[model samples]
Target: MSPSHRYEIEGCEVIWAIKDDSIGNTFFDRGAAEFFLPHLTAGKCEENKPLKRLKYTVTESSSDSPKKGDTAMGGALGPDWKDGWRMKGKHDQAAHRVQVEYQCEVQEVLTREEFTRTGQTAECFPGTSRAEEQNDDWPVYVLLTNKRLYGCDFVVSATGVVPSTGPFLHNDQFSVAPDGGLRVDDHMHTSVPDVYAAGDVCTASWEPAPQWFQMRLWSQARQMGSYAAKCMVADRDGEDIDMDFCFELFAHVTKFFNYKIVLLGRYNAQGLGKDYELLLRCTKGLEYVKVVLQAGRMQGAVLIGDTDLEETFENLIVNGMDLSPYGEDLLDPNIDIEDYFD
Candidate 1:
């Protein structure tokens, strides 16, 4: 069954927009409400007025599409994600269509007084007041607003990706690109010398996704930080660094109303599935099983509804075990494989 569109934010359970309902989604940071632009603008104009707003519309579709009247606007630049322009849409005969308009740069930070008082800018945008909008250099306090502050060397353009979603990498040395993203060389140490970054801040290729990828999950950020630290420490010790671990071993499980969804590895990884064998079964509700193989060994897998099997599944994928030895007997409901997992 197709999963329903549902998510809990700040304890609010939100569902997709239905027919004759004017319900809309919101995009917000700790500061300003970014996704509420349409509503805000709509409030400022007549109901039938064409929206003269600055926003992004998807340029094309790569695979999936959103539901009717559903509009997903955000950058996909986090761990296990890519950095690029994304377009999401849905079709609903009853609700008004979510129209994508123009491209815009969303500034979510502090105000003028707060910026000048301290050299740091807040994490939110509007940044500071109009009075403090003149300063161009970092270490210079340009108040993005009254509540938040930041210490930035430069502001780079992250135009291709979504705005306000913390998908940029966090680096020790900060530099800005002309397009609004940051540039840094120290975070993770690599087999290649002096090339590293962390968080949703960098344009480095070593990231989970390519440049312009939007990343915001805290776990992804922490992992990036840890990996970068490991690299830096390894370099300081003159160690023969191994870069293999940088590859992501993804696992995620979540509920959509009544149904559960689980994903493993980088199932989205291009061409990875070409050589892999797949098995699927439908029992209680919907259960999906995918096994990846390379040279007759298990490379990775995905399991829905049985996260308890994560370790066993991960072991098989990572070690490239000869799953052929067990065959379909492994799926026998009675088999307890946990004992064999290390």
Candidate 2:
């Protein structure tokens, strides 16, 4: 029987089906956060690039020398951030306890009736917490997918975004990026003369800095619009304009889940690929600081909570200084990073 009220749910098991696209890796690791998040992501990426709107990195490295490090330790700071980020415990329980997932695609979401009609009975419980207390007394619906069924109750949709290019999709007179953002030059000029576009509707067609790339974000949109105006003014007077310094390296400051977030450069080691390494340090409650290093140069970072390191990190990224010499001391949570760099 289909569910009616809370009491009416006793006989029928209602389950939200989430199909995981990660193959042969086991089903539990698929879309674990999306399955739990109350809000789904609403962002688009460049075509073939396929960027995710949000991702989490864990800080699990304390290597005194060098190693492939985790990127999440930069966010755990809690109370002592203003006082030079003086965090207490170095390792809070365990550093790598969090299971961070990304690029998890939900192939489909099927209703209970559809699941039954299709006759999928894959009993995969990767989504179930290992700490789950057995509640066999509570009858639940039979859950299954092309991947496997999850122990957690609730439906998950993995469609992050499809760009709304609108009427511009069919116009051949102007160039378009694969994501349908109007192709814009460094000066924010469209292919057609006298035409200008910026913000979410535009994409960068020029070569970008090593640690810089475009993403659909509030800060970027504001920066783009402002720069486009300047470029327009410069063009009207026939004056040449240099690309804004803001495009030199990525810098984003905002709040997420009540914590102040500062992302600089390739915060998540985006395009660095296998050659990059991460340095992470954190206290459980206070802050998380993650630094990305490629061949000993600062490439990017993710800073969470209130540990004040944005200015120093931003300069380091812009300067492209080699930091392989510092090793572990680079991310010491107790040190005055700004003072040292100064």
Per the 3 Å backbone cut-off, how many clashing residue pairs does candidate 1 have? 63
Q: Write model 2 residue lDDT over 1-342, tens digit each, in one string.
A: 100111112221224332233311221122222222321211111123333444335665667765565453543222222223221223322111112133343454555555556654534333544454333222233333334443334443423234456767566778888887889989999898899988778889999988789977657877898899999999999999899999999888754333456888888778777998878876654667778899899998877678888999999988988898899899886778799999
* TM-score of model number 2: 0.59
Number of colliding residue pairs in each model: 63, 18
Q: Name the candidate that leads on lDDT.
A: 2
In model 1, where do residues sit more than 4 Å from their true spots? 1-196, 203-218, 233-248, 253-262, 340-342
Error of 1 at 95 (Å): 20
lDDT agreement with native, every candidate:
0.41, 0.60
lDDT of prediction 2: 0.60
Off by over 4 Å in 2: 1-158
Could you give candidate 1's per-residue lDDT for residues 1-342 as a string of tens digits?
111121111111111212211222111111111222233212111123333423344654454765676654564323212113221223222222222212222234334555655545343223245464343443533222222233343333323232232443354344454444445443453323465666655433334521012244434455666777787778788886654343445554443322334445543333464765554433443444555555566554545444366678766665656777777666665677766555
TM-score of each: 0.41, 0.59
| 10 residues in a row with least lDDT, candidate 1 | 1-10
